[model samples]
Target: MPILTPEERIGQVLAGRYRLESVLGQGGMGFVMGGKHELTGRSVAVKLLLPSYGAEAEIIGRFFQEAKAAASLNHPNVVDVLDMQIDDGEAFLVLELLDGQPLTDLLEERGKLPPEELFPILMPVMDALAAAHEHGIVHRDLKPDNIFISKDLRGRVTPKVLDFGIAKLTEGDSSVETRTGGLLGTPHYMSPEQAQGHKNVGPSTDIWSMGVLIYECLTGDRAFQADSVPALLLQICTFDPIPLADRAPELHPAITQVVHKALARELPDRYASMEDFGGALFAACREAGVVLPATLEELFPQHRPTIAPGELSAPPPPASEPEPEPVPAPLAKKPASKIVPMLSAVAVLLLVGIGAGLYLATRPTPTPPPVAIAANTPEPTPEAAPETPPEPPPETPPEPAPPQDVTHRVISEPAGAEVVLDREVIGEAPLAVTRPGDVASLEITLRLRGHVEQTISVTEESPEEVVVTLPRRRSGHRVDPVGAPALAPR
Candidate 1:
């Protein structure tokens, strides 16, 4: 069969239903065409595997893998794979038509985006990744080009993840490794393990890629860059990128921390899952004063637990109490007196006769003699008042002196070299180290592989940045060998 040009292929009907309208986009493996369903009259996008790649088993598998992986996902931020079919030896997948453009185009248009604008686009993307992670799917290749920003029917911004051609399913024996030509993922976006060509990569790989995407979106530059793929891979594997805050100084430190955590060199140091990454990203954006277009619930929908038949009944109504009988009032008590009233008149006469007989029997008693009193004991003199010592005046603490602004910028001829301060390794070169301003001077040591170590003392009056140019190390020979030239530092 003769190959048809893209223009000639336009209007061609696939699967007897989707009619190709125009070429929407094209990539190395396939072409995405604008199409319409003839029977339903609904617009859609058709992804066709390139004719040249159709016969290759791996390419064909990936093409179908994209459909299978995407179709399994049901998220507002993930592209919907509607139908897939093979016609005339070419495989195609029908997807929901997106109105807007890819995130790469947006980044090209706007050099760098502010957090307020960037977070809205990325939060949903993170949510979609979180969902994919829950389903045990890893988008091995995640970058701006694979992210699409569209406007829904209500004109709200919706960012959708596209092209799961290289997605890795983490279940059973169905996992497909796409490490072709010794490289599995994009060098700039790959984590250290992925860049080093590790066989087992999980959700943390995607998290690292998302961190790179966020760094790019904020700084309009790649997190890692090199002139060649090998150099880029080496950097990803062994070197640290410049801090996000240094690249985008206006960004909040919390935002920088979030990105840094995602891009940690070690897997253990990185975010464990996309959910953690999304939570941290949302919190950082919120703390940075960037208002997201959606709330956390909208970004991360909570899974409602399944309720059984008897689980969701309304609480029984409170029991009503019976009315109590009225309390009876107590009667007033009579006043008591020492003498009884006329009721006891007979008893009183008997008591008075007894008292008169006692008074008649009692006669006059004899008086007792008085004793002599002792004389004069000297009066005790008043004790002298002890003196109260005055308390020493409260000493006023000396006022603390203001701290000095001791910020030193360290730069090396070849940037990204290791910087050591006071025998302790600080961050990489081309970074600012703020020490206690009270120090008279800071001893900074710069070290790079294949270069001689250089040390410099930075004082308060020193220039803003201490620039050090290190000489290349020269190898020493115990004995001169034939054809060996003299060694000298470069």
Candidate 2:
């Protein structure tokens, strides 16, 4: 059978309450369409898998598994899954229609983002992952393309994580089987373990992928790149990524450290949970003085604890009440006038005797004698000899001078045009730069290893400053071209 045209695709979606209006987009697995629910008349996005994959038992299982995982999660940052079905050998998913662009599209236009701007976008993505992870779901394919930046009615940006078709459920055994040399995710964002064909991946795998996504978003290049998939895999396994500061110097050291830790080749070294990762990322952003839009809950949903039966019920009421008041008494008083006159006469006689005694105690006494002075004429001649030569004061040693202030800035660069700087890496994007007080001559060196170093000079104006727009190295590697593959008929 020939590939179904747009009209044929729309006809396939019209069987149920959904009425297809136009083509939204297409990818390796399927095409997304703009549609409306007939009963509710609400706009929705319908994703129809290609006929070839829809008929396969394994692909069908994976599709349903994705639907189940997504259905179990209900988060503001996650795209809502309305329904799923298989009709006439074509499987499709109905999702809440979004009015925004994928992060991938934005990245294509702006190679990398400043730390101040990158965290706001990343926080929500982490939040969506945290929600899915809580529900025992791992979004195995967590690339920029799977993240969308949509706006609410108030025009505030809302990140919606999409495409869970390749996500794995952690509660039970994997429902779908894998083929050798047949990985289930985008090559650029897949973790080292995933690239090595390991099947027992869990939340850590998603964490690794998220690390790569953030690395790419801040540096304008994937964490690992090669001429082919095998080379990329080798790099992911053995190579230490170029420091983020070398790419985006404006990012704080804490921010770069977080990104590096997330991309750690070993899963144990990475963050334990998406929530942990999100918190670190957010904290780094704040330390760098970058303001983010959403709260931690908005980025990572809070776990709702389950209450057992009869745990929070109210208690019983009171029993009774009772009575009255009472009264009280008085009396007794007597004379003071008779005692006053006798006491006054005694007090006057005592005052007269005390005044005479005080006058005799304070009188001054007479002075007495002075001794004779001894005069020696010989003592004056000795002083005149000492005045001839006064010994010079001992020379004072000079104090050691303070150490010269050395301003250090490390800059890292990838492909395209962005630079990252860090004093000492702590966690995520937006590194801090420390400079000397006096206008010191600052050297900005761009290193993309295997490429020539581009050195430029800047004045030390601010202690912690970031410069984002920088020139790219002419000799660095370019992105590989994506190609279309042929799909078999249903």
Candidate 3:
């Protein structure tokens, strides 16, 4: 099979309905084009695989698998795959036409973004990934270029996740097309395991890529920076990234923590799922005081409206429109005075009869006295009882004393340092005295860079004040502490 000219390729059939319009994008395996259905006149985006790609059994299997996987997912955030077919020795996929620019284009235009601006866009992307993961799909290639942001007429941004070409489906019994040694994803966004060409990439791999994308969005620089692909891969696998604080001081510590955890070289350290990743990202945004957009769908919508080539006219009115029925008037009322007098007369007669019946019922007959024999028996029992003495009253037990409340003030080396109490972080230091019994236990943890963690506990009788001095760690030097910080009530 030979490569078709640009014009010849535009005449392909997709699902035996859509006719390709013009080339939209060109890639190694296929090209996407603006297309329209001939019968229904619905517009769509058609992706056609080149003849060379279709000749490879593995590539063809992967393409159809992507279509099948995408078809199973029906989410607003994910691009819809309408149909897939092989025509004239070329494979084609009919998709919903999206009206938006790729996230890569936006990022290229704007070097970096604040948390406020970035999270709203990133959230929907995460949502799409979450949906895919739920369906047993892992989007192995999650670069910015695969995220499309479409704007509506009102300028609302809607983010739609696209291109599941390299997605891994966990549920299906079918094997993956690529072998262990072949590289399938872009280097910059690939996970450490992915960069190593591991065949068993999972959801964690997607999380790592998302972290890299987020890091790039926030700092205008990739987390793993190296001169070559091999160097970048090595960095991803072995190097610990510089903390966001060191490179981007404007970013908050909480925000850096989330990104750092996401970018962790170890898979176990990253967020467990896309939902968890999204939640942490939003939390970071809030910690930084960054507000997100109203709705993600506002960023992208189907661009091509359904319209015939020559039929431009008004749509028909709705078929059903019912009129409301009229309400009835109220009826006239009867005279209340006549009705009340008759009812009161009946009530008086009834009460008189009831009182007479009660008097008759209360009248009772007289009773006779006990026999002489019974009185003698009672007298004999009384004489026998006189010999026994009354028992002493039982002794009362003493009551327990009330617990005394002891109060103690907490004092740190730095007078006004922030404090964490029982895992709940309280406001800045110089905290007032705390009474024992107020809480189950009082454990104070102080956080200061380069300093060993300082913890102090407090109880009723042993309430004490603490003087915490943070020690500075020398650069490139490690410290072996004598013991873990102990909790002592003061």
Candidate 4:
């Protein structure tokens, strides 16, 4: 008999039931087919393994293994496995026909998605994971390709989890056990522990992958990228993903915090479970005033209120009225106060005198070379003493020398934060400036976006290079209004 391709194998009736229509899609382990039940004539998606792979007991076992894993989960977000069979050299599994495309395709079409758009889809996926986790099952391979997003009859974009081929049962179900240290997940989506091929990868591993997925969904960028699989694995192990908030500042801190917790490398540092992660995500959405969609149709609801062209040309809708201001009751007036022109005059004069003294004290100092000259010059003998006798030695006072200039280089962790000297904007950071040595103090400040203003005291003993790593602003820190220094006159 001639060998038939997977597509050629299509249309062939299998076990007197499913009649394959055409190849729907292909994957690393198996390909899906659009088919109809012969007796019922109902539409369904059939997943089957390649014949060559099916000939092996292990691959055929895994094909059935996936069917078993998915059959255990009873959740709407998870793909429902219907049937499985092995006929001759062919092994196939049947699944519900999804109405929409994979998340991978959607992401490829749209660079990055807004928070409002991704929240609903993510909510259901997280729910599915939570349900699976409760049963001690971990979806070891979770990537955009395995996440099927479909539109139901109601037009709700429902996201369903697909492909449990490599899923590991943590409760010791005694099914097929993954060989220890066997690499079994997509490189880009693998967690640090998973990438390391650790023997006992747990739910936290799935949580890490979910974090990377959410990050990409919100930011339109991969959390980690490399040229090859080994390089990608190294990235997963060692690199700190660029923070989601840094890429999308509009995201609420609560949402970003949830991601940070989920992606934490250490087990204790990360969210304890999917439940905690979900709760935090929901709390963040609530705090941000984002209402989650409860209905299937709400997955891709109207992002902004729809307005007609005519309405756009018309005056804008009135804004919400502000709270009424309180009116204070009238109070009795006090008697007239006496003015003090004499004290004001004294204060003005004192200020002027102090300013003048400061100016004189900072005057350019002259170098006294005569003292050095005297030290270098040799005294004349007794012959020259007669001529020198005419000029009586007179007491000469030495003058103070002028201040020299010193240079200091300033730098910051994220370069380009504004540099301030004594509250005056000198220049942006990564700067070199010369200051007079006579100055009493140099108060240096660095201001960067999303970070609290950093201040430092510079002295002569300070190092030549001044570097400051600005810290993120603390919550509840007061924002000071613009003003000058308060002065108390004596």
Of models 3 and 4, which has the larger lDDT? 4
Candidate 4 lDDT, 1-490, residue by residue in tens? 6777668977888767779898888754457889888877767888776554667786666556655766666566788666776656677776788899888888889987777778777767876777677767788778888788889777767788987634452212322223344334467887887766677777898889899999998898899988877798787788799987789998888788888888888888988777667767776776787776533221212322343211222332235867679976554443334346777889999999999999999999889676534556777765544444466688787887777777878877556889887678889989986767776346777898745577776656555777666543312222121121211211
Taking all chains together, the TM-score of candidate 1 against the true structure is 0.59
Candidate 2 structure quality by residue, lDDT tens digits, 67-127:
7567566566778677776655666777888998999999998988876677777776776
Clashes of 1: 0
The 0-to-1 C-alpha lDDT of every candidate, in the order given, reads 0.72, 0.65, 0.67, 0.70
**True lDDT of residue 239, candidate 2:** 90
Question: Against the true structure, whose lDDT is highest?
Answer: 1
Candidate 3's displacement at residue 188, Å, is 0.4
User: Model 3, poorest ten-residue lDDT window?
Assistant: 481-490
RMSD of each: 27.7, 24.3, 29.8, 27.9
Off by over 4 Å in 3: 11-16, 165-183, 293-490
**Which residues of candidate 4, in runs, are more than 4 Å off?**
165-184, 294-490
How much does candidate 2 score in TM-score? 0.58
- TM-score order of candidates, top first: 1, 2, 4, 3
TM-score each candidate. 0.59, 0.58, 0.56, 0.57
lDDT of 1 by residue, 1-490 (tens): 8887677899889878779999887765568889888877888888876677678766666567655766666566778677777676677777889988899999999999999888778877887777677766788789998899998677877788988634452111222224333333456787777766577778898899999999999999998999988788788888778998788899999899999899888889998788778877777776777776433433433321233212222333334855678976653444445345755887989999999989878967668679665688578999999999999999999999898777778777556789987688888989897767766566678888745677776666566866666543322113211122322211
